[model samples]
Target: MEEIFAICDDITILRDGQWVDTRPLEGLTMDSIISMMVGRELTQRFPEKSNVPKETILEVQHLTALNQPSIQDVSFELKAGEILGVAGLVGSKRTDIVETIFGVRERSEGKILLNGKEMRNRDAHEAINNGFALVTEERRSTGIYGNLDITFNSLVANVEEYKTKSGLLSNKKMKSDTQWVIDSMSVKTPGHETAIGSLSGGNQQKVIIGRWLLTQPEILMLDEPTRGIDVGAKFEIYQLILELAKKNKGIIIISSEMPELLGITDRILVMSNGRAAGVVETKNTTQTEILELASRYL
Candidate 1:
C-alpha cells in the first residue's frame, strides 16, 4: 500500500474478478481502498480474538533439523486453543522448525510428543496420519497442484476417505467435500472444475487452507500464510485461524510480519539464527524485545 500510494498514478480495484473502479490515487485512504476491494466497509483489520489457551497438546523438545544452518534445539509447547507465533529475521530458519516437525525436512535430533506420546513423523504421509498438517511457505511451488481443478486439490489431502467399497474414488463424496471447501473457506471460483491456478492468490490460499482442514489435524502449522494476500483476504484468513483455535486446534504460525504475530497470537516463540531465542507473552512483549531476541545468536 505504501508503495502503491507513493508511485502509482492510478489505482484500479477488482472485487471477485470484476472491476469495481479505476481512478486517480490522490484521494484514496487505506480504508477506502480496502472497502472498495472487499465490496464492504471492513470494520476491523483483525477479528477480536476469543480463543483461550488450554492444556498442552504438542511438544517439540530439542528439535534440531538434519540439514545444516537450520533449526537447532528448538523447543516449544503448543496448547489446545492457542495460536503460537514464530517470529524471526530472514535467515533465522523459522520455516525449518515446522518443516522438520512435519517431516518434510529430516530431524537430526529431537522428540515430538503429541498427547504425551512420541510421534515419529518420518515423512509427510506419516505426519498427516499422526494428525499434523502444514501449509508451506511457498504456495506456488510447494503448496498446490496448479494444473488441477478445485475438486482434485480440495480432496487430494484426504483422498483415501472418498474411496468406495469397489476400490474406486467416489465422485459423489468428492463433490460434496469440494463444495464444503469452497463454501467454508469462502473461496471465490467459477466452479469446482476450474483450475486452481487460475484463481487469485488469496482464493487459492483459502482453498489450500480448506484442504488441510478436512484432515481434522490436532496441530496446524502455517508458514507465511498471508504473504501475498490482500488485506481483505488476510482478514478472512485471520478469522478462520481464530475460529480454529476456538475449536481447540493448536495453531503454529511462522511469519515475518511482526504486527501479524502481535495481533493474533497469544504467545510468540522468537527465533534467532535457527535457534529458539526466547518465548514471550504477546501482551507483554514489544517488537523491540522480539527484535532483540532475533539478533541474540548473531
Candidate 2:
C-alpha cells in the first residue's frame, strides 16, 4: 500500500458519493489528508469543561455483578455537577459496572447509595424511579424507537407526566414538551412527527439523551455516548454533557476514547480488567499515565 501510494502521481478522494479534490501525493501528508477529510484541524475535537460541584451525589461500594464477576469490588463516589469518566480497553468489563449500578444487570454483592440512602437491587424501573437514568451503549437496539416519530420517542420515558385528570394523554402538553426538547437540544428534524429512523446518527443520539433528561434523573450514566457520531456532532454532545453537569447532575461517562475522557472529564476512573486500577484528576493526568493505570490489573 505504501509503495503504491508512493508511485502514484494523483489520488482521488471520494466521500459519500461526492468527489473531493484530487491532490498529488508529493505534498499531501497524512495529517493534511486527514484535515481535508474532516474539513477542519484535528485540534478542535473536544469542548471546554463546566465547573464541577463538591457534594457527593452517588456512591457505589464493593460492586460485583452476578452475571459478570470480572467486575469485582469496584467502588466510586460521584459528586453533583461533576463529569466522572470511566476509561478502559475493550473487554475490561466497563459496561458491566455501570449496568450493575443502574440495575440493568443483577448485583450479587454491592451497595448503591443515592444521596446516602441504600438502593435495593429491584430493577431498571426502580432505579429510574430513584433518580437514576442509563443511556445504554446500544442506542439503535435499546435507546430509540426507530419506526416511531420524534414525539413518541421523546415522551416514552415519562409519558405519565402528560396524563390528564380524565386518564387520557394530553396532546397539548405532549406537543409542547416535545417541541421544547427539540428546540432545547437543537435536534434537527423536519417536524416532530418525522420518523426517528429518518434522522442522522447525531440527531438520534440527541433525541435519546433528551428522552432520558425528561425523566428528571439525578445520576446520568452514559456508556460510550459519542461512539459512532461524526466529529462535529461529537463536539455538540460533549458541550451538552458539560451543560448537564453545569445543572448539578452527577454525570458518569464510560468511553473507550482516552482523549475524550481527558478532554471533558473532571476525574477519570481507570479500569484494568474490570477492577479499579486508579482514579486521577483529568487536569493532572496525561494519556500515558491513564494507559499505565488502565494496564495495572492486566
Q: Pick the candidate with the highest TM-score.
A: 1
Please provide, for model 1 over 1-298, each residue's C-alpha lDDT reduced to its tens digit, 9 standing for 90 to 100: 8999988999999876688999899878988988999889999888998999999999999999997989999999999999999999999999899999999999999999999999999999999999999999999999899999999889889988999999999888899999999999999899999999999889999999999999989999999999988888999999999999999999999999999999999999999999999999999999999999999998
| Over 4 Å off, model 1 | none
Candidate 2 lDDT, 50-134, residue by residue in tens: 5767799888999988875469999999999999999988878899887888888888898999899999857888888999988
**Candidate 2 weakest lDDT stretch, 10 residues:** 11-20
The all-Cα superposition gives candidate 1 an RMSD in Å to the true structure of: 1.0
TM-score of each: 0.98, 0.88
How many backbone clashes does every candidate have?
0, 0
Q: In order, what lDDT does every prediction score? A: 0.94, 0.86
Candidate 1 whole-model C-alpha lDDT, 0 to 1 = 0.94
The Cα error of candidate 1 at residue 153, in Å, is 0.5
Clashing pairs in 2: none
